[model samples]
Target: MSNVVARDIELDFLDHDFEFVGSENVSTIDSTYASQPYWKDVLSRFVKNKGAIIGSICVVLIIFMAIVGVGLNEHTYDSQIIAHQNLAPRVQGLESLGIFDGSEKMTTSSGTVEVNKYVSANGSVTGLEDTYYWFGTDVLGRDIFTRTWMGTRISLYIALVAVLIDMLFGLSYGLISGYFGGAIDNAMQRFAEILNGIPNLVIVTLLIIVLKPGLLTITFSLMITGWIGMSRIARAQVLKLKEQEFILASRTLGARNFFIIFKEILPNIFGQIITNTMFSIPNAIFTEAFLAFIGLGVPAPMASLGSLISEAFKSFTTHPYMIIPPVIVLAILMLSFNMLADGLRDAFDPKMQEM
Candidate 1:
C-alpha cells in the first residue's frame, strides 16, 4: 500500500505547470547602458578638469595670437622708427583710462611729471596720438606687440619640431631596445646613457659653434638631448608591457616582431607616451628661451621671447614696459602647457584619477 501511495505522488509532481518569465525583455535590458570609447572617455574626463580647460583655452588663444597677432599692427617685427623709440603703450580705447596713454614720467626741472611720450618724442601729439602701439615701442622703435607675437611664433615652431623629431627617434629606439631583451638592448641603453651624460648646455654651445646660431641650430641642439628622456620613458613602458599575456598570445600566434610591438603594444602605451610628449613641450620652449636669453638664440630681425627679454633688459629700468610683455607671454605659455600636461596625465592614467 505504501509503494502505491509513493507512485501516485510522483505522478502528481510530473503534472506541474512551467512558465518562462521576462524572456521578451532580454534585448531591452541592455538598451539603457551606453558604450564609451577610450578617447571619448579620456576627453570626458579631461573636460571635467577646470584647470586643464582653462589652460587649453589659454594655449589656443596664445597660439592663435602668435599666428595672427603679427599682422594686426602696421609695424613689422623688424621695422625701426627712431622717432617713436621707447614710446609708452598707447591703445585707442584704453587711453581714456589714463593707462597705456603713451605717457611716461619725465624727470625734468619741474621734477618727475607724467608727459605724453608721443608728444615729447614727436614734438606734436596731433596725428601721432591717433596711432596705437598696443604694447609700446622697443629701444629699436619696433612695435613690442608685433615683436612679442613674432617671437612666440618662432619659439613654438622650434619647440614643436624638436619634440616631434625626438618622439620619432625615441619611440623607435625604445621599442626596439625593450622588445629584444638581451645584447641589443644593453648596447642601445649604453649609447643612450653616453648621449645623456653630456650637458644640454654644452651640446647647444658646441652646436652653435659648429652651425650658425639660428632656429635650425637651436632645434638641433634640443633634439640631441631631448630624445633621451622620451626613449627612457618608452623603454620603461615597453619593458613593463612586452611580457604580458596578450603579447605572449600574439607571439604564440606567429605575429611579426614589428606587428607585436607596434600593433599590439603601442596602442596600450600610447596614452603614456602622449602625456610625456605634452610635458616635453614646455621644457623645449623654456630651453629655447634660455638659449635665446644668453645670446645663443636666433639672430637679429628674427625675434624670440628670449631675445626680446634680453633686449628689454638693458632699458628695463627706464622703460619697464619692454620686458613686461614678453615675460608675461612666456610665463603664461609655459604655465598653460604644464597645466594641460598635468590634466592629460591624470586623464590617461586611471590610477592617477581623482576620487
Candidate 2:
C-alpha cells in the first residue's frame, strides 16, 4: 500500500512539474527526487540560455579557427605563390597536376606561366580561369588567407598575455588596498587615480615613440596601464566583504593577512574577477590593434589584425582585398568577444538566478 501510494504521488508530481518529468527514469535525478543540486540547476538554466551556448560556441570555434585553421595545417604562411600573384580566388579550368606530374603550364594573359593546379571556384569557370589565389592577393601579392590567420594568432596571443598580466597586478593591488585600509590604502588609491587620469592611448603612443615598437613593447605598454580598472573592482569587492562576521572571525583566529585576503576574501569575489577579466580581453586586443594601425605594434613578418589593417590601408584604392579580409576578421573577432563577455556577465550574475 505504501509503495502504491508513493508511486502514484511520484507520477502526479512528474506530470505536474516539467523538472520532475524531465528527470524521470534517471536514477541520479530520482535519488535527489525533491530538490535539484546546485550545479545541476545552474547547468540546466545555462543550457536553457541559447545565447550563452551560442556565445561559448563562437568563442571555441573562433579560437580553433585562429589556431589549427591558421597554424599547424599550413606548410608555410609566408610562402609566395610567385606565379599566381594577384590571381582572383579559386579560378577554375586552370587546374594543373602537382610535383609527381610536374608543375603544369597555364596560358595566362601575362604569358605561359608554370605553376601548380589552379584552385576551383563555384561550378563555373571564373574569368580568372588562369588565376587562383584562394583568398586573392595584395598589391605586393602576399597570401590573404595566410596573412589573416597569422593576424588572428598574433591578436589572440597579445590579448591573452596582456589580460593575464592585468589580472595578477590588478588583483594584487586591489586586494591590498581594500584589505589594508588607512595609509597604505590612501597611497595606493592616489597612485591609481593619478595613473588613471592619464589617457591610455596617449601613454601608449609616447612609449612607442620612445621605445622600439614590437610585440613586447606593445604588451608592456598595455600591461603597464591596464591594471587600474581591475584594481578598482577588486578593492570595491574587498571593502564590501572585509567587515563581514566570517572575515572578523578569521582575523580573530589570528589568520595571516595574505591568507585572509586570498583564501577568505578573494574567493567570494571570484565571479567579479572572472567577469572583469573577460571584459578586459577585447579592450586589450583593440588597444593593441589600434596601436599597430597607428604604426606602433608588431613589425612585419609578425602580423596583428591592426597592423594588417594599416598595411591594407596603403592599397585601399587599388587592391581592396588586402584591407577587406583583415577588417572583416577584426570585426568578427571583436564582436564575438563582446558577445562572449556579455554571456559571461549574465552567467555570473547572482540576480538572474535569484529571479
Query: Which portions of model 1 show Cα errors greater than 4 Å?
Result: 1-33, 106-111, 120-127
| Best-matching candidate per lDDT | 1
Worst 10 residues of 2 by lDDT: 95-104
lDDT of 2 by residue, 1-355 (tens): 4554444434345554654535567667334457876556646655776776776787787778777765543434566646555544442343333222213345657877654334343456533344445566655556777777788888888778867876789999999999999999999999989888888777777877788778878777767778888999999999999999999999899999999999999988887888788788888888888888988888776777898899889866545556877788787777777766666566667475456
Task: Give per-model TM-scores.
Answer: 0.87, 0.75
lDDT (0-100) at residue 222 of candidate 2? 67
Give the root-mean-square deviation of each candidate in angstroms.
5.2, 11.9
lDDT of each: 0.87, 0.74
List where candidate 2 sits over 4 angstroms from the true fold. 1-42, 71-75, 81-83, 91-131, 350-355
